[model samples]
Target: MADLDHSSDDTSVDSREESSQDSKLEFSEDEETLVALMYNLIGERWSLIAGRIPGRTAEEIEKYWTSRYSTVSE
Candidate 1:
């Protein structure tokens, strides 16, 4: 455990900011379903998807969808 350095090594940020960032990264069930529906409709238009779901960015949405759906070859 002494070798691990998960916390800030040199910089510090407010807890509220950390929590808000954490919240943005998390995807609730409803959000997931919405992402799926929107994906079916728009087909990888990440900016549009992010527009439908506030607080989430296209980059994160793309990352989440790929992570959730990716397997073996894809």
Candidate 2:
């Protein structure tokens, strides 16, 4: 029989990819507000939010937040 030891790893990879795809646009007001509140409460700790919201990759949130910060700083 074939081994299925890599199943979990494959699922994780697929989830990450789906998150990346979902990050292309702005999230709804509810989601954005919730994520922002959570970010303020946790500060640079996105894995927590990621756990609650499916397809919300940490990279996308970090990038969007950084971009907003940079724009404001300029």
Q: Identify the leading candidate in terms of lDDT.
A: 1
* Candidate 2 lDDT: 0.72
**True-structure lDDT of candidate 1:** 0.82
- Output the lDDT of residue 37, model 1: 98
Clashing pairs in 1: none
RMSD of each: 6.2, 6.9
TM-score computed on alpha carbons, candidate 1: 0.65
C-alpha lDDT of all candidate models, in order: 0.82, 0.72
Across 1-74, the per-residue lDDT of candidate 1 in tens digits comes to: 54345455423456766776566557999999999999999899999999998778998899788877877592
Candidate 1, poorest ten consecutive residues by summed lDDT: 2-11
Error of 2 at 16 (Å): 15
Off by over 4 Å in 1: 1-25
